[model samples]
Target: MTAQATTSEPAASEPARRKTAIPKNPGRRDLGLRATLLFPNREIVERYYVPVIYTACRTCYSEQDPDEIFRRALAGDFDSLKMQKLIGSVIESGHGSTIEHVVFTFAISGVSRTLSHQLVRHRAGVAFDQQSQRYVKFKGAATMLPHSIAEGDPDLRTRYEEQVDGALGLYGDMLQAGVPGEDARFIFPNATRTNLVMTANLRALIHMSGLRLCTMAQWEIRRLFQLIRHEIFSVSPFLGSFLAPKCVPLGYCDEFNNRDGHCPIRPHKDRVLEAWAEKAAAARAAGRELPVT
Candidate 1:
């Protein structure tokens, strides 16, 4: 029997072997370069957020109030470089709402359903639309073979294929057997991945990117964000530049697990606080005062 044919298993069965494979031509199977910016086109960006957000940062310091600032910014009364500098500083200071006014929509294609499931967990500041398993019968559905499976033991990898194929086989059988698609879908594994389209405002995109960009985020999701970041950079490098790991903005790592400081992204927030406290104590002992932000 064909290795593919022999490797099938029931939905409840575990893999016959423990090996996982990384695809030989990984790039061929890669969810390569997914996510296309669909709306709020470049014209909209040059006409709107670039100026609007710039105005938001400048208004506070300028003698002119926000209305006047916005008018002048849109009217090209100020240099983009000066405006960007102020926006950069204000954003760094945690003024997030000013950047929230602009949004980006991406046509995210070729991601696994697995990635999409974890992605939608983010409730605030984002939106999503996925390829519906119910609406789409998936006559020619595709599946992802994880890198682990690709690079595993041959025997173990064979077993893994069998399990995935068997699950897909049962799904097809159930569909042909008149079982409802929803119920038949119980056989689908987390690996039975799918695709989606997602959208977010600059605030949300940056926020989500921050969380998922962390080392703690799942690898697949991290890779996906890297692609998303690339897409943003293609259009407006200025806006795209904001998408980054959360620690980049925080100036230090805050994750509790980093107490040992292994992640190395930044000094732990606790450690920094403790150092500040120690300095304060020393100052008090010396009859001096610690300056506060």
Candidate 2:
């Protein structure tokens, strides 16, 4: 008889391995999520987006009128490099209004309602119009299957699919019985796919990206932002660079859940503060004072 191999679980006494933050790479698989830059293509962005922001920033400091500054920018009188440098500096300095002059519109589709619920929470400098379930009755509504459930035990995965299909079927039955679409939609699960059109200014995009790109964010939404970042990058790499995890610019992770320092992207804020305290203590021993910000 041929020898057989057997798998064994880890010893009970062994410590569980710490989960490290792995940055998500988009386009790995078709999760059905799609984010397309619906407005302001490359040419439009290259010609107007930068100039518009530059005009906003220049008007704040220059004695010239805003219209004149904008006209000169559009006419290519200003050096593109110089405009970008000033814009970069102003953005870094937190002059958010300067970058708010330009906006991007994206047609986001195939994302779950769960993701949309989290996405619509962002209000400032952003506008969203989502597909209304009440107005448009879905003939065959599709649902998102989470990776965990999809990859779990075969029996469980089948059960999850059945549960989702049953809900959708019941919804269809209610509609056939003359029930209102709005009332029938009550049977829809959070996993039901949704479509949205979002328009956000530069400042708001950066702010939203910072929060959503963090390792602590929900996986589905993080993936959506990844797609958003990719769409932005396709138009202007300079602007796309600003869409990053909050910790990348902050220099420390501030999420309360990161206290254990599991996410390796950056040291936890507590660790940073602890190091500062140590330095301060060492300076005190030397009879000197350290500046505290």
Per-model TM-score, in order, reads 0.80, 0.90
Error of 1 at 151 (Å): 1.5
Residue by residue across 1-293, what tens digits does model 2's lDDT show?
Answer: 10111224458998975544564432245677789999989999999999899988998899999999989999999999999999999998889999888899999998889999999999999999999999999988978887667656989878878888899999999999999999999999999998999999989999999999998888789989999999999999999999999999889999998798877899999999999999999999999999867
Which candidate ranks first by TM-score, i.e. highest?
2
Ten residues in sequence with the least summed lDDT for candidate 2: 1-10
Say what the RMSD of model 1 is.
8.7
lDDT for predicted candidate 2 compared with the true structure: 0.88
Best candidate per lDDT, number?
Answer: 2
